[model samples]
Target: MGYIILSIPVFFLLIGAELLWSAWTHRKVYTFPDLIANIGCGIGSQVVGAFTKAAIFGVYLWTYDHLRVFTLPANVLIWVITFLLVDLGYYWFHRLSHEVNFLWAAHIVHHQSEEYNLSVALRQSWWQGLFSFWFYLPIAVLGVHPVVILTVGALNTLYQFWIHTRAIGRMGWLEHVFNTPSHHRVHHGSDPKYLDRNHAGSLIIWDKLFGTFQPEEEEPVYGITTPLRSWDPVWANFHYWADLVALARRCTALGDKVRVFLKPPGWRPADLGGRERPKEHDRTNYLKYSTDAGANARRYVLVQFFLLLAVTSLFLFKQDSLPIWGAWVLAGIIVLWVMGLGLVLEGRRGALTLEAVRVLLFTGAGIAVWMSVLGWSWWCAVIIFLGAASMIHLTALSGEGEVAGQ
Candidate 1:
């Protein structure tokens, strides 16, 4: 219920606004394929995880009906301790996801993109829920209420959002202990030495203690060793799985088969057999250069962000009965989906048509909000109708997001 209520329109609204603002800003180019694939994967994985969490919690509640485990203290100290421990649990799950092959398969999606943006945070793996939730079972077994776990998880996620940007540099001593943008950036790098390093989610201590730590030595190269190479969301989500499965089948020995899939990014089946393996070119500096398609896409994302803020505030003012807080929450989701669409269609010429439709719909919605605030009758209805029409048109144009003059 929380996922549906919080995710649906709210998610779309924030992401939509972000994309509009991103396009308008013209700072960097973003890819529609990257945007779309990332958002699709994010939503799919999150929704699936949400459902699994709820079902498991329900089962726990039924089994332990008499357990009175909501022992949250009245003091602020207890709350702080709980929050810190939740971060520790997340760190374990996150670090393990990097060390274990099956876990890495689910996590690699987030590191697949070359660009770093808020949307990149949404580029989650579809299979991550298959195992990540298991790490949290101990909390339930210890009788922490499911509601508390979910709330802390959401807070942990929200806290991570600010760390996903190049816009924020490192903070002196804080950089050494916290997972700041600089350290996190190194974690996402594809540079040979930087691979499988710095796997902190909310805290940096896990990486430090477990010796999975590597500081940002070189300016990192982002994305996977075997790039997904396509904007298709389905492909981005499953390509690694396919590669691992295929490599497993081709292995002559059972141990070699399992080892090949579980080894580091550049490892091959022949490595264990002392046979020659195919050489790969160094992509050390690939992400440094700028692409025209990338520039346009980033511009689109900037435009979406500002537009979301502007229009959402406008809507809140017009609908005086709606809470002010809800407007900001709505704005975040709109920005996310917009970035998602932009990434999914990157390098395709069809993005222009979608942009046109998005602009028209938003313009109409803005006007309607203004009209309602000015006491215009039936204006809100017109806005709704036009907004729906615009979205439908945009949906139709989405297929052509990679093509020009469509």
Candidate 2:
């Protein structure tokens, strides 16, 4: 997670380059709402990961402490072997995420984006970091040092970031060994042939060896089987789980209820319609989900979202310094701010109300800080001023937003 945080700047730079290429070529690879929502999902995931990551890593550390068969030296060759093992662990965790229903519920957010770009790499699941460490415990148990496990794991993550783009074509020979952009594009595809192929972090050999590899035959249609049709990051995280729970409730048999989570997604009960074969979805004339939000609403969303990103970054950097409860509180605020931004992007009617509530929270936090100091704090004063400005902008643009929604 620290590695990912440090690389956020590079991610945006690459994303910006992709945008420029799109504009220069008129390829229509990005939409404003989709870009915001993708980054929003990433931000929310990082913020959530901060609260739970230390304990999860502690489990790996505990396994290393207690279960090693032989003490392994952290030599150069050992580093290489550990890197391979960590990536292999990631591959299984990723493949299983797509296969099992419950895991998919945690992972499906990353694939919800209809557009594939560098930004898509950052569109992670908030809870996925929780489940992946279990898969890495085996490496820890094999006498691999915890430091090696973590460093290589972070490297594997960083390596995959550049693969989430259409800006680059096939890397010829490299495509055969490493997971290149072409391989990853197929993984993101919703086309029947590409549904579950190419589940690798950095190496493509795992997919080839396991018979899950699919070369790019045609331009692939990206996103999940069913379109999310939403910009709400909060909904992006939990919608699949909600869908699974709803399906389970509809199942009369107890076994079917359990299977709803264990089985592959779209695996309905016999009475509910059994497994859904992936139908052939063509790339021709496919339209991604979007909204016709007014200019004021769009600008407000854009500005506020950047502000949210700043605060989220600060929270991630200082989470360990603050009390656990304080960290959680800060995370909740950031998450709500992200949700509100998403709602505003979608031109939802009640978004302004949500924004108003968020503004009040911001104001309250600033007040708390101000009172604690018994005087002015520059940052607190800025927060109050920003909250007032946000409300004014919302007031000024309410009519335009309603018009756009209509």
Candidate 3:
């Protein structure tokens, strides 16, 4: 995670480059709300993961300790093989997330974006790590040290980040061996033909060998079959599970109720129309989810979003040294801050009031944590300034819609 924190600037640099590419090439590859939602989901995932990874990764370490068949030597050959094994593990996990119902609920947030760009790569479900770690336990039992698995796993993940872009075209021969942008774009597609097609991590061979590979033909219509219209990243993580729970309650048979989670996403009992299939998307008539925020509201959320990012990066960097209770409280505040700002962008009723409450609460919490760490200082004034400015903007936006520039 420390390495990921260090890599944060590079991620933003590439995203910024992509934005410039859009400007130069005249391609509308990003929208304001979608980009915010994407990164917000990512922030929540990291926050949640910081707390959850110990227990989840513990299982792998335990497996290696007790269940190992061979105490493998830490050699270059072993490192290379472990890297491939990690990729294979991720391939299976990624495929299962698409095929299975409960796993889909964990991974669906990644596909919620209608637009594909570098930021979309940041968009991930908070629950995905909890579900995915189970898939790698076999490698642990096979005697790959947990350290090897963890390091290579991070590299495999970082490799996929660059592939989540629109600026890059199809790589010629590399397309056959590796997961390129074209392959991943198809994975993000909701079109009937492209649904659940390419599920590769770094190597494309897994998909080719497993018979799930599909070449990019037409430009895909991105996102899931059922669109997640809301910008609230918190809701994006749980919405599918809520849908599954509602579906379970509707079933008459007890077994069918349990099957609601065990079955694939569109599956249903015979009484409830069997299963839903992906519609043949007519590209000409399709509409992406568009909930517009006024220009000023957009500007407000944009400013606050960056502030949240900076604080989130700091928290991730220092979480190990922070008190457990402080870490938990700060994590909750970040998640709520994301929700409040998302609601504001969605222009929902009472969103400004909620944002106001969030500003006051987080500001107070920030002061408490700061005073404890460094004793009272002028930094408290900076926090108060942000809170005051946020409140003032909320007041201005209370009545006005899109005012003149900031």
Which structure among the candidates has the greatest lDDT?
Answer: 3
TM-score of candidate 2 to 2 decimals: 0.96
Looking at model 2, residue 318 earns an lDDT score of 65
Q: List the residue pairs that clash in candidate 3.
A: none
What shift in Å separates residue 135 of candidate 2 from its native position after superposition?
A: 0.9
Model 3 weakest 10-residue run by lDDT? 397-406
lDDT string for model 1 (170-276, tens) is: 68999877888888888877766777778777778888988888888756767766666665455666677787788778778889788866675445665445533
Alpha-carbon lDDT, every model: 0.61, 0.86, 0.89
lDDT tens string, model 3, 80-109? 998888889899999989988999999999
The C-alpha TM-scores of every prediction are: 0.64, 0.96, 0.97
Clashes per model (N, Cα, C within 3 A): 74, 0, 0
Relative to the true structure, candidate 3 reaches a TM of 0.97
Q: Which runs of model 2 end up more than 4 angstroms from their true locations?
A: 366-376, 399-406
By lDDT, the better pick of 1 and 3 is: 3
Which candidate ranks first by TM-score, i.e. highest? 3
